[model samples]
Target: MLLHRLRAPAVLLALALTALPAVAQTPMEDPLDARDARRVDRMEKVVRELRDIVFKAQRTGAPVVVQPADTDARMAELGARISDLEQSLTRINGSLETTGHELELAKRENEALKVQVKDLTDRLAVAEKAVAPPEPPEPPAEEPARAATPQEAFTAARQLMLSGDYAAAEQAFAAYVQDYPEGPRIAEARYWWGKTLTVRNAHAQAATAYIGAIRGWPQTSWAPDAVVELARSLVALKKPTDACQALAELPKRYPKAPTTVTNRAAATRTQAKCAA
Candidate 1:
């Protein structure tokens, strides 16, 4: 720094030396000339003080620039390199930021894809259920089967009668008659079938069935019972005369009827007001 300050004094001294020849060529110097010489002396004294300042400043550790032009060129080159490095760092930072943004976008897209896949899976499950065939219903539990024998069928029908299920008993006896005409209890089935119909206030149908039982199976034990019930059914049809006629024919049709059957016919004939 002090060496640069010394340059101004050196330039002034060179200018002063160059002007000394012109000064010597002039006439006896005027007051202006003496003033010029005094001014030159003051400039020389200032130049000397600048040299002493330069020496003192150098000892005080002030850096002196020896070659200003070369130092300026080197500093310019260093500044340019630093600026280039800063620009490169800026570009690198920008590139890094761009990459980070791209990665984030990809991550978001991946997450969205996963969500879509999950939703599709759920919908597929629901769709499968919607289109799937319904399960078949379970079969009902089977009841214990009844015996299919003639005696069993007749007994079942008689049980209905004992239980006071006249309609069911009539249906049962009719089914028995259809399935087994030569059943062991066929005669009883026909007779009881008529009795069931009569109990249900079906006198006209009962009369037809009773007559069929007596004529169809006259040799059977239930034939005489059919004849007795037939007369009773006729009385129920509001035909006392027809009932009396049926009772009178019973002795001729079934002479071998049991005492109980004969007694029952007599009681029915009395109730029906038959001619003595």
Candidate 2:
């Protein structure tokens, strides 16, 4: 009978030890509670003393002293605490999930706002360009005056040449030539026009002008000089044979020509590399 009593207490202790791991695995809201820890320590000490008593009775044929454990109420309270802790943890996890979802929605809204801002900016630029104004039209040009007579035109052209306005002189002389092909001073005008062309380095045009000036060998005061100028223009044109021929005719055509004219002709022959 005594053995039966001891074995009953041993079986109860074994069941209690097996239940401990399941209780320990339960979540706690506050595992560091001093009151709860002290209650657990008292229960463990009672179980250890009971185990030692049972072992001594079995070994020495003595009566076992088993202490009644006061742990049932405390274990029930701990279970309630663990249940509350699990509910609290569930609430906290749900709150965190809700916050993450709100952040995701906020990010999507922010991105949409950025796209809207860019679209609005482009629309504003187009609107500004559409509302801007057009430019004004240009004015008409003035016409140059006409000279009343051919002499007046010719005198104006000669004055332009004398004033060193070569560009205006060239245009004026060209206009005079067109206006008065049969003018009294046409040959002299051609000669002066040739002088302007030579200043402009238009040697070929100058040669043509000089030829026209001395046509039929007019024997005018400027005629001998015009022949010398013609030979000079031919030499500049790289026609040495034509230049020498023009120079050869100078003495026979204008024998009483000025010393200046004769001297220029002699120099022109040397420039042309003329023989004897």
Candidate 3:
């Protein structure tokens, strides 16, 4: 509206300033001529007035320019620009929101993929273990040299018997005898073998072991004990007469035996009622 008010005056000022220059350009006249003196004076006064107007306009700012007959159109054009800018901003915001949703979905998918990959890796490890061959059970670790001497071997077998590991004791005693046929401990081994058989109620086998012990090592420390075990096994086999004969032989066979052995033999003889 201020532009409207200033436009007409600025146009009038510019027109007057330009027209004065042409009006002052009348055919060249003598400075001393009185006939055109008033015309020259009027022209000079008008020129001076126009010059003053130009100076005043220049002293102020440049004129606010407005095209003619385009007020409504210009206002409509500005309104359209503002509406377009608003629509562009709305579209940009909508696009940003959509992008945010897409990014969140991508993150969730990535996490799911990571979980799947981890599960697959774990399953693959287990599968590899299952399909792969066993480690050969570590080769049994070499099992250090068992017994350095015959005595050691015999003692080991006897310890098994004392500990009531009868099965292992039997195997161990048999192994001892086979490994050391002429060892000093062989007689003791045979005696213990007989005792072990009797305890297992294998009276027939016990009798064989006792007889073998007596025949193979009759002068050894275990002979008296072997005879006692033989009698017991024969009694268990329902041969009480054979058992009594075995007991009767113990005193004469092991005459130098300990008093305890001698007493046990005498008692066993009384139990069996052997002929004197």
Candidate 4:
């Protein structure tokens, strides 16, 4: 009976030892806890004491000693693996942070480059406008057909002047003077040209045309009128003395002038404040 009790205790202790190795070899999802480790150490110490008691009861002179459970070695290996995992996670996190910072910097640089490109484009446009050539002026419109003869040209020019087409009349009369320098109506054309110039407030040019028309005091019907116009132009030019001089010659040069010419000469002299 005594041997049986001792054997029963030994068998129970052996079963506990076998079960402990199986539990230690089992894979765990989580790290070992301090409390669970302490409990396992107590269990191993109890199993060792029980084994020693069983051997003593069998009359063995030597005390049996057990090596430490594999659980401690496995726990140490699990701790190292957890530490490695933490380090890897830290490295991964650092890499992600660095990449994110680089991305932000790149984005900022890209935006700045975009702004610079736009500025350059704007400047290029302005430079192109500055250097670009101006558009050519439009061509002059077609003019009226030329008159067949000097008489026809002079008549056309006179008709233009009477019709209030002063721009056309000025061009026509100028053409008449060029085409017929010695034409019969040259003096009359010149006088009408001066009238057009005076209408446009071109007193300086009108004076020149009037002087040309009355050269040598021709006895034509327009001569006295031309002389009066010359004096009027000189008055407009602020040359009162020259105006008076022109008016003084109207009577001496053209004694047969009409009453209208005499009246105009008197008025011009008064305007010039001429010496009586």
Best by lDDT: 4
Q: Runs in model 1 with CA error above 4 Å?
A: 1-149, 181-184
155-223 in candidate 2: lDDT tens per residue?
A: 887888888877677677777777889988888888888888889789999999999998999978999
TM-score of each: 0.42, 0.47, 0.42, 0.48
lDDT of 3 at 273: 72
* lDDT: worst 10-residue window of model 2: 137-146
CA RMSD, predictions in order? 24.0, 17.8, 20.6, 15.0
By the TM-score metric, which is better: model 2 or model 4?
4
Tens digits of lDDT, candidate 4, 155-256: 999998899988788878888888899998998899999999899889999999999899888888888999999999999999999999898888898899
Rank by TM-score (best first): 4, 2, 3, 1
How well does candidate 4 score on lDDT at residue 170?
82
Candidates 2 and 3, the one with greater TM-score? 2
Model 3's alpha-carbon lDDT is: 0.76
Q: Cα deviation in Å at residue 202, candidate 2?
A: 0.3
Residue 19 displacement (Å), model 1: 99
Local distance difference test, per candidate?
Answer: 0.79, 0.81, 0.76, 0.85
Off by over 4 Å in 4: 1-142
Model 1 per-residue lDDT tens digits across residues 1-276: 214544445556655655665665477745457788788777765555545555654466454544345568899999999999999999999999999999999999999999999999999999999999999965533322355798888888888889987767888888888889888776667789999888878889889878767775467777888888998888888899989988888788779999999999999999899999
